[model samples]
Target chain A: MEILALFGDFTVRTVAIGAALVGAVAGVLGSFALLRQQSLLGDTLSHAALPGICLGFLIAGSRRLEPILAGALVTGAAAALLVLLLTRTTRIKSDAALGVSLSLFFAFGTVLLTYVQRHAGAAQAGLDAFLFGQAAALVPRDLVVLAVVGGGSLLVVALGWKELKITTFDADFARSLGRPVVLIEFLLTVLIALAVVIGLQLVGVILMVALVIAPAAAARQWARRLEGMVVLAAVFGATSGVVGALVSASIRGLSTGPVIVLVASAIVVASLLLAPERGALWQLAHAFAQRRSLRAHRVLVDLYRLAQDHDDLDYASEQGMLDTYFGRRTGHVLRRLERRGLVSRAHHMPEEGTHWVLTVDGRQQARELIRPFGERDTTLDGATQ
Target chain B: MTGLQGWLDQPGVTIVLVGALVGVAASLLGAFLVLRRESMLSDAISHSVLIGIVLAYLITGALDTPLHVVGAALAGLLTVWLTDVLVRSRRVKSDAAIGLVFPALFAVAVLLINVYARDVHLDTDAVLLGEIGFAWLDVVRVGPLEVARSLVTMLVITLVNLAFVVFLYKELKLATFDGMLATALGFRPGLVGYALLALVSVTAVGAFDAVGAILFVAFVIVPPTAAYLVTDRLWRMLVLGCVVAVGSSIGGYALAVAYDVSIGGAMASATGAFLLLALIVGKHGIVARALRRRAPRPPPVVHVPEAGGAP
Candidate 1:
């Protein structure tokens, strides 16, 4: 009831809805950005948008969102293009280019912003708020801008999935198919700028980078196909947004962006460790179990070989001999094999140590295993002979 | 008498010195970072160092303590370590891992700041955009002369970084250009890289109160990057990067004074101005390359002596 009561607040509802839209759109676009290895571009573009925001404000002579966002998109595209140009033409590597563009454009913007603050009198208010955005500033009217841009970008992605997918996974292949690789790249960069600017008012620039990256990275762990990844990422992003919005609203006066970023990062952390097949923890466990079974299987085969060498079906090999043969302790491996009914422990004499002998079932299993190696390495007989 | 004392006494002198010192320190380490293609690491380290500063402050209940820089160094190393873990796990790519780790640390730091903000005067805005205008207000007496504490701090950091660069020049050059060879030769390039980033972290923390994190990142990356475009030699790059930084500091201060804007911000922007200049004039620059491309290509000539063997 308390949670429901909180959501009933108009401001909270609007902010939550807006944040969800921002998350979903960014998730879809960020997948391609990640695959392109241009994840840092989001950071560059977002920071680079500051000057455009200032210029737009100056031109419009108002605190209107449309011109400001327009200006942001323009500079964002320019920064992206500049990065591409530096990488293509000069020896400037992408990371250096990114750092270069990010600092320069942000520096330019900061300079412009301070300049605006001094000259524009009181009219130039709330601009500094963009540095760390106030999510509570989200009004009902602004959600329309988010929805139109977010929905339009989503629509474009749906309609051009084939071209986008080909270009994303393999640009040269797409170029071979006569698709305009350069144009598609430009379009995607623009879409990314769109995704970044959509939530600039709610999340700010620094946190926007995290939003674009975290959800998609988490989705990568679970999804096998591009479509599935896109959908899953969107879901993850939306969930982070809504949860963060609620949590921040519940705790009075806390900004929502960092909270949202923490939630998204939390999701990524969980997905990395706990996802079924691709998860680190799951793979670690799988590898551990596989190694254990492999050791046990090796011990089983060694016993069978010993029996065959001695020309006795029930030939016993001392554990010490087996240990030296394997060059390690085999007590645990022998015990495990025995537990599996693959081997049996015996004593030849009181003065001698415990010995291992293959059981009937173990011999049969060993024969099954040995048969594969024999078949696969049949050429080995010819080579040896 | 407009001698050194009078000039130094002006607020402008302190601002430029503070900016220039921070710039020199950052550019020294940033050259290697740029060459290794880990330039973005500065961005990540600067953000994550906030946690260290906040933790140190929380423990000590004061700002500008030596523990803050130590804590920041540890935090910087922690970010690199965590990013390495994520990459090694094969769960996430390196960039994503970096993106994930730093933001998580930054978010936690911000939340801590917000939660404990009432008890302390640690304003986030001030931390984000430092007040270099007030640098001369708080002065520490060094002998008969009183100096701004930030200037002394930046001076020490600059010297430390300079010593690191000078002492380990060969090691850094080898590691930056050929990491595997360095590792094979038992140089432990990875350790050197971490030590380098740790100092970067310490410098970023030290510079935080003067230029803030964003501008610190600017100083760390931009000047060296500008120098990279202009020079082929490593030593030239180091000197050129410092020159770019000092120039930006002086020029930006003048611009800031002229327009009445943020002095630090203008200084950072001035690096871009110099980079743009480098782009047009450097040997490997855009203009030179374009001019060459526009010129006619020469015919491929075959040497008579080697032609028979080649055929």
Candidate 2:
């Protein structure tokens, strides 16, 4: 009931929906950026938007969303283009080029922001919020602007999905197939700039990269295909946005952007540890299971060799002898085999330890293992000799 | 001589001197970083060092102290270590690994500032774009001489960085160009790399209170990058980067005064301008490429060549 009431609140609803839209768009677009290894490009674009936001206010002379977003788009695109130009024309690599553009543009923006604050009256009060977003300041109209821009970019991504995939995975092949790879890449850059601009008011400049990257990175761990990755990223992004907004709204003095970033980072941490196939935890468990099975197989083969050396097929092998063959793991393996009824352990004197003998089932299982490597089985027999 | 001495005595002069010192120190380290292709680590260290600053302040009850520098350096090393751990886990690529570590650390710092140090002067805005104009106000008296605190701090850092680079020039060059060879020769390139980063972190912390983190990055990366474009020799690149850094400091200050804008921002912009200039006129620049393309290519080998070939 409390949660529903919170959602029913107008400011909360607007901020929540707006954040969700921003997250979903950033996530979807971020998949390509992450896969292309342009994760820091999002960082560059978000930082670069500060000047544009200030420029937007300067041109429009008001705090309206449309002109501000337009200004942001212009400058953001310019920053991206400048990064490209620097790398292409100079000896600077992409990382240094990106760092140069990001800091320079942001410093320019900070200068502009300070200028506006000193001269532009109290109306410029909320401009500083772009540094660290003020989601509570989000209005219904702001949501409309976010949805239009964010939704439009999503639609464009969906339409250009094939071109983007081909170009991202193999640009030369795309060119050979006559697919205008450069133009597509430029368009994709524009789309990413648009995503960054839309999210600026919700997530702010500093933390916006987290929103763009964390969800996509998390989703990459779980999803096998690009399509699945994109969808999962969007879902993770929206969930973070909505949850972060609700928590921030309920709490006093907690800012929205950091909370949203922290939540997304949490998702990434969870995914890294828990996701199947690729997660750290799953890999560790898989390795452990493989080791266990290899150990069991080694014990069974050892037993089969012992039976071959003795006159009787069921001759018991002392645990002490097996320990010499298999190390300290011998007792554990024999006990496991006995539990499975593959072998039986006979208790002798406690000082002498136990004796183990293979059952009929164990002999049959060992024979099956040997048949696959029948010719190679001679190697094992020779090693024993 | 009196007039020049008076000009040198002004607070503005102190600010510029401090800025130049910071520029020199950052670019010195940045040249090696750019050569190594680890320029982004500077960005990572700058951001993550915030946690160090806050933690240092929290522990020492003072924002500006040697402990703060130590804390920041440790945090910078932590950022690199965390990035390495994430990459080694093979769960994420190096770029994403970098993206993950710094922001999380930065967010934690921001939150700590918000919750614990709200009453203090540690504003996040100040952290992002420091007021270098006011740097001279914080003067310290030492043995009958008064000096701007930032200027003294930056000078010490600059000298330390210069000494390190001078002493390790051969090892750093070998390690940067070919780590395998450096290691095979028993130089321990990895240790040199870590030491370089440690100095970078200290330089960043020294400059942070004056120029801010992002602008510090501009000083660290942009000048070195511009110098790299202008020259091929490492020694020349180092000297050229320092010149660019100092030039931008003076030029950016003049622009800031003329326009009444943020001085640090203007300085960063000036660095960007220098980079743009280098991109156009440097040996590998677009203009040179265009000129090479348009130069009359020896009028394509004519039928005379074809006749000789036939013979």
Which candidate achieves the best TM-score against the true structure? Answer: 2
Q: Judge the docking of candidate 2 as incorrect, acceptable, medium or high.
A: medium
Q: Per-residue CA lDDT of candidate 1, range B209-233, in tens?
A: 8878888888888888878888999
The lowest-lDDT stretch of 10 consecutive residues in candidate 2 chain A is: A376-385
Task: Provide chain B's TM-score, model 2.
Answer: 0.93
For model 1, residues A160-189, the per-residue Cα lDDT tens digits are: 999999999999999999999999998999
Clashing residue pairs in candidate 1 (N, C-alpha, C atoms within 3 angstroms): none
lDDT of 2 by residue, A342-376 (tens): 99986655778788888878977877777787544
Q: If you assessed candidate 1 against the hidden native complex, which CAPRI class would it receive?
A: medium
Error of 1 at A338 (Å): 6.7
Task: Specify the highest-DockQ model's number.
Answer: 1
Off by over 4 Å in 2: A1-5, A346-353, A370-385, B1-9, B297-311
With candidate 1 superimposed using the best TM-score fit, by how many Å does residue B271's alpha carbon deviate from the native?
Answer: 1.1
Residue A357 C-alpha lDDT in model 2: 82
Instruction: Score residue A375 of candidate 1 by CA lDDT.
Output: 44
